[model samples]
Target: MIITKSREEIELMRESALVVSRTLGMLASEIKPGVTTLQLDKLAEEYIREQGAIPGFLGLYDFPNTLCMSPNAQVVHGIPNSTPLQEGDIISIDCGAIKEGFYGDHAYTFPIGEISEETSKLLKVTKESLYVGIEQLRVGNRVGDVGYAIQKYCEDHGYGVVRELVGHGLGKTMHEDPEMPNYGQRGRGKKFVEGMVVAIEPMINQGTKRIKQLKDGWTILTADNKPSAHFEHDVAIIDGKPELLSTFKYIYDALGVTSTEEDKFRSKAYD
Candidate 1:
């Protein structure tokens, strides 16, 4: 069943989401060539605890690290290691936090320094698809509506949408009901209702949609060994519209980048 959140509970979730947003922002400056994923993971754990929130991904599902540090061809769930990131490399950092008894989860793909033109375009399109999917999370829209929006947006750009791993409803527990796929037909899944909150993420591959798993039983990779980009956001339905509980403003601020992409989804000024 889809568990909904009250207005008060939604505010609590917003707090949890901001915890993660701030954590990502703090890591933005640290992500550079020669930095190991494990080092970044350690920093995230300490920072989350300093915020009085537990690392949501740590010890959950026996996962060993605070972040799912997937780089280059790795899609998601890539375990953090001692491998130092190189210039032109892109890493997807999926993070989570638990605060006020609620969970906040999201991911962002970052370029180590400078990346190829092709890889840059992949990241740009995948992130754009995330907002396109978010726009479909409305009062009367179905789950498939969101998926179709994401899938169509990426596919039109000749990108492959991953099928196995998907976005999910977020609340007390990490994962919840109503699996949010990136590919589906409109009006074919559960109907979205008010007070519902979910993590809508798009995992788009630069090659075929097929994927493979690593021997570690955690990492997922593209079948063709091509790069994949993942972007996510925590959203809730309020007043019959989708409201962003998480903001990229912190990350943008840290990077000295500016964009109004999230303005339309926000109800008020993001502070």
Candidate 2:
């Protein structure tokens, strides 16, 4: 069953979500060539604890990391290691946190130093597809609406939308009802309603959509060995519209970038 949140519950969720956003922002400046993902994981664990929130991913499902650090062809669930990131490599950092018994999950793919023009375009289109999907997350819209939007947007640009992994409803737990896939037919699946909060993420691959699992039983990678990009945001339905519970502002601020893309989804100015 889909668990809807009360206003008070939503507020608590927002606080938890912001803690994750702030953590990602703090790590933004630290992501560079020669930096090990294991090192970044340590930083994230310490920071999440400092904010009075527990690291949501640590020991969850017997997994042993604070963040899912996937680089290059890897799609998601990549474990952190001592391997130092190199120039031109892109890494996706998926984070989660728990505060006031609520869970906040967010993710972003970052480029190390500079990347190839081809990879750059893939990143740009993948992120744009994320917003396209988000635009469909309104009251009464079915889950397929969001997935269809994301699929069409990315496929039009000749990108592959990952099929195996999907986003999920989040509140009090990491995964909940209503699996949000990146590709689907319109007017299908569960109908969205007010007070429903979910993590909408688009994991698009540069080549074939087929994926394979590593022997470690954790990391997932593109079948064709092509690069993939993942972007995510937590959202809630309120007053018949979709409202963002997560923001990339912290990441943008740290990188000295500017964007008003999130203004449309926000009900009020971010404090």
Candidate 3:
């Protein structure tokens, strides 16, 4: 069953979501060449604990780390390791936090250093597809609307939309009702309503949509050995509108990048 939150509860959800948002922002400046993803994972674990929240990914599924560090051809669920990320490599860092009995989940694909133009465009298009998906989260739209938006936006740009991994409704638990896929037909699936909150993520690959899992039983990668990008945000339907509980402004701030792309999705004018 779908677990909907009241306006009051949604506010609480925002608090949980922001904890994760701030965590990602903090790591944004620290992500660079020669930095091991395991080191970043340690930093995230400590910070989340300092904020009085637990690492949502840790111990939840017997996962050893707080972050899913997928780099280059890896898509999602990549375990953090001691590997030193070098120039031109992009790592998708997926994070989660449990605060006040609620969970917040968000992700961003970060560059290890100065990357090539082709990979940079892949990152840009994937991030754009994310917002396009979120734009479909408004009240009165179906899950398929969000999926279609993401699929159309990325496929037109020659990216492959991952078929296996998907976004999901989030609240007290990490995964909830309403599986949000990146590819689907319009007007199909569940109808979105007020008080519903979900993570709208697009995992787009630079090659074929097929994926494979490693022997570790956690990491997932593109079967064609091509780079993939993943971006996500936690959102809630507030006052009959879609409101973003998580923001990438901090990430942009750390990377010294400026953007007005999120302006339209901000419920209030962003300062």
Give a tens-digit lDDT track for model 2, residues 1-271. Answer: 9999998898899999999999999999999999999999999999999999999999999889999999999999999999999999999999999999999999999999999999999999999998999999999899999999999999999999998899999999999999999999999999999999999999999999999999999999999999999999999998878899999999999999999989999875555
RMSD of 2: 0.7
lDDT of 1 by residue, 85-188 (tens): 99999999999999999999999999989899999999999999999999999999999999999999999999999999999999999999889999999998
Query: Which candidate would rank higher by TM-score, 1 or 3?
Result: 1
lDDT of prediction 3: 0.91
Residue 140 of candidate 3: its Cα lDDT?
82
Scored by CA lDDT, what does every candidate get? 0.95, 0.95, 0.91
C-alpha RMSD (angstroms) for model 3: 1.2
RMSD of each: 0.7, 0.7, 1.2
Better of 2 and 3 by TM-score: 2
| Full-model lDDT, candidate 1 | 0.95
Worst 10 residues of 1 by lDDT: 262-271
List runs of model 3 lying over 4 Å from the truth. 268-271
Q: Model 2, poorest ten-residue lDDT window? A: 262-271
